[model samples]
Target: MKKLILIIGLASAALTFNSCERDITSLNEDPKHPTVVPSGVLFASAEHALLDQVLSASVNRNITRFFTQQWAETVYVDESNYNMTARPIPRNHYNRMMASASAVINSPGVLSALRDARKFLEDEGVGAVKKNNNIAMIELVNVYAWANLVDTYGDIPYFGALKATAENPGNAEIPYDDAKTIYLDLIKRIDAAVAMINISEPGYSNDLIYKGDMDKWKKMGNSLKFRLAVTLADVEPALAKTYAEAAFNAGLFTDKSDNFGLQTFPSGLLSNPVYQDVIQSGRNDFLPSDVLVNFMNSKSDPRRDVWFTKVAGLYVGGSYGDENTFSDFSHFTNAISGENAQGFLLDYSEIMFLKTEAAARGFSVGGTATDLYSDAIKASMTEYGINDTTATAYIAANPFDAVNWKKSIGEQAWVAMFNKGFQAWNFTRRLDFPVFTNPAGSLVEGVPVRMFYSDQEYLLNATYVKAAAQKIGGDKVTTKIFWDKF
Candidate 1:
């Protein structure tokens, strides 16, 4: 009889077995393992994997916090200095998004699992309304993953990725897709997904973000559309303006309550990834970076009171990429470092800031740039629990700088996006604000504009990867993503 081993929560699992029939083909069937997994389980697992990879502070998988200089390494500073090869960071992220092979628990990946869920949902012949809403939710998540991949790597195997078959195995070489083309298509997908969301019906019941709340899902879809439009402002201004306005017309996150967030479990494999990295790891390799803290300190940002702990009665950060004593630097607050802390995917604060940028660029996104900017800051302050008086005062002091709106919006967006490393990195790259200097002993001369394609891709799909590298002007860390035209 074939043996089945189930792995659970980053640990080993052993299954009890009974004697099987004598037939060889019968031995292959494991009763404990079902041919089809419930769509909800696959969807939920996919969501967890997506959030864990994106929201994690793990040096091995993700280090965007260091890349954006929001956090600095205390000892092993390779990642902080733009070293892409020390670990398979890009590979881990890539796998989290597109890996097709299923684990013992039916967890494929973000795209793979969601695609599988769609297939299973179709196979089961669910009701039209429920199925449409479920499929829409899946598409929304797919769009988010695809956008993230395009933003990280200049080009990727889009149409060819996550589609393994009997004739075409998972390891088959796939051609790279143009990033701009992919972004345009993703915007279309978002629009379709939003259109399909029947608020009166239900969504994925196992959803970690909204718990079958199709209304919130619909809002998030439009919110995502607006964010993507803003990303294209420098590259596709007219298209960007049209979509931004369309997204506003559709609707968006009305307030903080509509933010897309994942609450951390109390314990086990489902615990907060941040808490796992900072507290459970039994290491002190990371601390807030001076690049961030000094900026926050300079503006007398009220959110700082709740973000970091005081050292010597003042919020102090470690010099970016420098080795420092763990006890000497300010640590992240309990609100962030606690085991049950929540990690956000999309925030109303971010949408408001996008609106601010859109208004600044002459897009009719519903308000003046100055008013929207203040609203963005106020939303961020409220999200962090700062009083209205303090928030208003801060906004008054740092009034919008129309001449340098990018700097004004980008810098504050960076602050507002604390702990959301990926979006913050996007802000820094697109807006080119709060300029970061190359860390001492760095791999590149300056901050990396895009993450290099996974090294494993070179070994596994050499020809296609080489073609992609050449198309993107070499697979170096300095290569800029398509939308980062500024």
Candidate 2:
């Protein structure tokens, strides 16, 4: 009887297993949620990731504005005082610039997403012309991301960056590459990307910057190349002149219409980063610095009205690095504080300023230094809705000081780049203008020249990180970047 019962139980178990085993894979698949994302989606993700790194004012992510003394902290003054270890700022930026495919699939980074998007296009057998345009866009974005990384932290992991593949999983421990070498290569990459572009054909449909407009993409590519060339003007003047001239000759940002950004972002989860920091965060933690406000106040800059709200009918700013009350000083105007403020990666005003600098350096970039300088300020004024007459009068009042071009151009560029901190920092560093002293109670001896390498690198890639630190003459905040040779 026991044997018979055992047989019956075994038979029953087998019957149940058979019923569940036949082609149940389809049942496990979710039709509503896709495992593979579209290439356009990946491209768009890359765009946002890049923008966040450059545009965010979050202390944990970006503090360039504070370093350059454009904005001051109200409550948490650690960042304002150049505290690197307190937050994972360098790590955040480094990871965003280059991350693994598996990691990017979860949290998209600039290079990783672009890598994935390129792979997707190839796998799907996209048409040749369309694919070329798409690849051009991808290459341009990649060049920008790489250039920004080099600018932020000199001698980064470039050659082996994003090289993890199925056959070579051991490629994760990448080696560091020289910043100047990387910059030179990046300029070449930009040229190649521009060459690949077929402007007549459609490109990325999910593009956040240009929205499938290859013409605008082409302009941005040249503009970006021009920017890189100008950045190397101090260190590699001949190469800089050659590239800058070529870039301008190819094409550049014609006006604000050619601006590269998502100007109109919807509120809620996808609200602008500036709005997130200033308003949506439910904290009044930032105020314009006296360094900026006093300068603008002295000039009687018209954009002050568009950018800030007056405190007691006067534009007062918080002292740099000192703790101050939020309501006691001027706050961002509704135009900036509101949900749908502009967030640009590159703009005409910036390109014009670059042209101004290029011309000042005697590089053939079309116009005279004074004329380009005037155009740049006019572009800034036009962007803020100030009339052409006001811009003309303002230009007249503060004419370009070609004798002290660095001071004149640098100060105005700093003002024009109010919320655009990274670019402002670059201009300040390259031109060495407006003279920044260390913030009160600063962590380091002087203002940071370059951000320290990510702390995680020392742990994971100890040997490489140590080697890089040694090569760049220590990873201190005061360590100047390769292109920042004064």
Candidate 3:
């Protein structure tokens, strides 16, 4: 009787195993999710990732703004006083951007994917037929990312940046490439992108920057060329002139309508990064720097209201190099409020200023230096929704000084570029304008020229990072990037 009972129990267990094993294959696939995301979706993911990194409040993002004296901190005086290395800012920036770029490139046939994505929109009855427009768009975005990397860290992995493949996983530990060579390659890539875009491809669907507008992307690529060229003006003047003329011929941004950038979503993960820092984080950290506000106040700058928030019904800024109470200082304007904030990766105002400088240097930029300078200021004012009458009055009141064009152009550009701390920093560093000075005990010897590679690079890529550091005069903030001759 015991043997019979054990046999029955064993048979029951076997039946249970068979039931669990039946059709397990069907359970492995989820119908609601995708194993391979559509190419357009992948591109959108890359866009969000890049913007998030560039716009975030970490040392990687806003620290440069402080370097340019656009912002100050109330409590976190360390960042405002130039202490970016206290955190893993450099490594984090590189890693995050590389990952984002990989997300776009990993899609099989990256260039082809761009075409296919636009084609899909065409099928949806919302896009125009264009040959490889998406490819140019992808290349343009890549140029911006690489440019930022080269500007921040002098020698970074250029050729091997996204070259990792199945056969050699080790390529992920990319060797640092020469900055000058990388800049040249970037110029080539931008020109190639401009050549590939089709103006006939009227509209797009998946585009986050230019809204599938081929013309705007074309303008952006060339405008970026102008910026990169001007940056090299000090170190390689001949190369700078060659590329600057090319970009000018290609056509830089003519107005705000030609601008290409990310817009702030009202809520959710897609909300503006600065808005996240301002509202969602519930942290009172940022203040308008005294350098910025005082300068604006002195000039009666029309865009001041558009650039800053009011405190006690008045505009005020926090003193630089000092810890001030957050509530006592003015914050950013309502345009940056969580519900309606938008930030540009590049803008018309900046491009106009670039033209002003290029024309002053005797480039065939097709406009007088004074007219370009005045137009740049007006473009900035109009961008912030300031009235035309006020812009005209401001431009009239503040006449352009031909004798001191460098200082005048630099200072005015610095003012117009109120929120773009990185671009403003580059302008200030290159032109040595507006006269930024740190308090005697600031953590920097003076304005930092470049950032140190993060400790992670020293640990994992020590041989390459060390060699690159030695080549560029030690891995310190004081060491200038190759293009920063100032």
Candidate lDDT (C-alpha), each: 0.81, 0.82, 0.71
User: Which wins on TM-score, candidate 1 or candidate 2?
Assistant: 1
> Cα deviation of 141 in candidate 2 (Å)?
0.6
Off by over 4 Å in 3: 1-33, 59-61, 100-131, 170-172, 202-204, 311-313
TM-scores, one per candidate: 0.93, 0.91, 0.85
Give the distance in Å from residue 236's predicted Cα in candidate 2 to where it truly belongs.
Answer: 0.7
Distance from true location, Cα of 187 in model 3, Å = 0.6
Task: Please give the lDDT score at residue 28 for candidate 1.
Answer: 34
Candidate 2 TM-score to native: 0.91
Error of 2 at 131 (Å): 0.6
Model 1, residue 184: distance off in Å is 0.7
Residue-level lDDT of model 3, residues 1-486, one tens digit each, is 243233323322322222222222322364533223334554554565566666666554447777788788887788777776677566666666653122222212222232223333333332334536766777787788788888888898678654433354432356889999999999999988888888887433556667678888889899999999988888888888889998998788887777666554535656777777766788887888898898888888877787777788778999887888988888887675554577777888898998888888878888899998888888888888898899999989898999988898889988877767678878887788988787555887777767777666777667888999999998888888888776
True lDDT of residue 227, candidate 2: 94
Compute the lDDT of residue 20 as modeled in candidate 1.
15
Predict model 2's lDDT versus the native.
0.82
Runs in model 2 with CA error above 4 Å? 1-35, 100-106
For candidate 2, lDDT tens digit of each residue in 239-337? Answer: 999999999999999988898887676565456888888888899899889889999999999999998889889999898989999989998886776
